[model samples]
Target: MRLLWPSLAVVLLLYPALAEEHNYQLAGPAPGSIRFKWIHGSICAATNRDPRVQAVMYNEDTYILRENIAIHYDAPFTYLLMGNKGALLVDTGATEEAEYYPLRATVDAILKRWGDLRGKTDLPLTVVLTSPEYLSENQGYRQFVNRPNTTLVPLDLAKMKAFYGLTDSWPNGTGRIDLGGRIITVIPTPGAHKDGVTFYDSYNGFLLTGHLLFPGRVMISNDADYVASLTRLKEFSAQHPVKWVLGSQIDMKFLPGVEYMRLIRYKPDEHLLQLEPTALQEALATATRMLGKPEVAILADFTMRNRVGPDERPGRRPANLPRIPQLPNLR
Candidate 1:
């Protein structure tokens, strides 16, 4: 009986992880259904404020506790909107199980949030692809293509929707979606994620960068395109001061909280708080130094050319992957 109790407790603890393998009942359109749950990643918690409304705040990674509208959910992260007007979604979640990268439940959940936005005046929603990897863009075509309310904007429609079914109306690269009062703008910031698009929210001074701008690690994108993309972001930030930088993956310390981003330039705008030049310089310096490594540079290049990031190799070097010439020993 003593052993039985222990065994039962162990089984209970394993339920949630096991449940992921099987299809679980989704918390569809239920009023006041906004609930936040902690999922381990750079970002600690993802809130499902209905489907049309979602947000993610990094616990430790990137800017501390910076919140952004999460577009889709690949289990961990979800999409977010900037007010009721328009939204910039980072990743495209999986579709169906048998499909290429079946995480469409996230998108299905998103569309159901505001009921039906199709032909309903203005319910602007633009999806931004931060990284152009397989999982990032695959299996997410149906939600954007068929949805009546949301607009599908891709940098390279052929590259973004390579394996998925796509329609001719899908906007490629630069485009704009009117989100009621605000506008969601898609600016192509390739490199970090091949053909990855960085979203700019002029209303809130928020930049939704999927995996493009991580705080702790070096901003590595070996491909010239990816490197150029980050450079573009830096230039944009220098010109148009951004108060907050929202990213998909990050490693942070807090459970759940919001952090203030130091605005370097653009005068004290209404929505953003001004940051000291020193702080901004330090943050950018740290980010720049990390990516300066040869290995990191190589990895970034590989990510851009092959449209893939470093693979998880347990004990051996990743097969056929590019190797950094003077790689630093990463623990």
Candidate 2:
């Protein structure tokens, strides 16, 4: 009977992993079924008195933590993905004031809860930003730079390509990381956003795309590069099942053909956070049709605002453009 108990325990442990793999074929939760589990209330109804960082349990292992718009106008959304071996925190949001924002503390609280639920202690945290510019734009990098049991993954093209084993080909260049049983594919997409990259969680069928393909103003820094990225994204999506395309910021207003003002803190009636694959294809088609044209193009769900000047061409930035601000020396 001693061997029987051990065998039974092994089966019990492997069952979840096996079942998760089987369910991946189905992609993710059913349509209209993948709603965010808000801690307080819906986005429109949530009171301003709620916590600055509201944690919404996206799924059993994935948590979508949104920064309060009142705290920062951008109010970017960060993701906490838990795995058997460790946990991954994607994006820090636009809050430099750690005392007021407390992103690390909020992450720690979620990690603690995750650890307790899994009967594990001190699951290492791997912090990764979608873009380096977020270090300046978001200003939340300082809060996590010196945290305990945390490793910040650099968002460098060469380094990330090597780390993820992405190739120069269409889908082969995509990097893959095994977060325990869950596998995340990292696609290097730089154009719409600087050093832009997208993370695809195969387990949950989530494509955590940052500013690259958000619903709001998708400022295209380079037309050619952005088109190539979109083509690659469309091809990648064809091969894999994408349940949700989650982005950092949302600028679409509740009313159709309307948008929120820039740097506006409060978003009373905003659009939904999640987007579908068709939206990506539409963006791709729009970019393909306006390949040589260096003018801004507005689509149904998003606007492709081109920032390229007369002297600059696609895939290259203007020489005189101001550089992104650097983080203060945390050491």
**How do the predictions measure up, each by TM-score?**
0.46, 0.77
Candidate 2 weakest lDDT stretch, 10 residues? 17-26
Instruction: Work out how many backbone clashes candidate 1 has.
Output: 31
Q: What does the lDDT come to for candidate 2?
A: 0.71
Candidate 1 versus the native: TM-score?
0.46
What stretches of model 2 exceed 4 Å from their correct place?
1-48, 135-138, 155-157, 165-172, 308-331
After superposition, which runs of candidate 1 have C-alpha atoms over 4 Å from their true positions? 1-37, 41-76, 82-88, 94-126, 143-145, 154-175, 215-219, 251-293, 296-331
Q: For model 2, how does the per-residue alpha-carbon lDDT over 1-331 read when each residue is reduced to its tens digit?
A: 8899999999978653221221322345422334643322223434456678887776668888888777776778888887777788888888788776888889899888777666767878887767766542346777888788888775565665555565355333777666676677888787766567789887777788888877677777777888888888889999888877888887766444345767666666676778888878888887877777766554545556665542232353334433436789999
Q: What local lDDT does model 1 show for residue 18? A: 21
What lDDT is reached at residue 199 by model 1? 69
- The Cα RMSD in angstroms, rounded to one decimal, for candidate 2 relative to the true structure is 11.5
Tens digits of per-residue lDDT for model 1, 282-323: 434433554443432222111111222343222333354433
Error of 2 at 282 (Å): 0.1
- Per-model lDDT: 0.41, 0.71
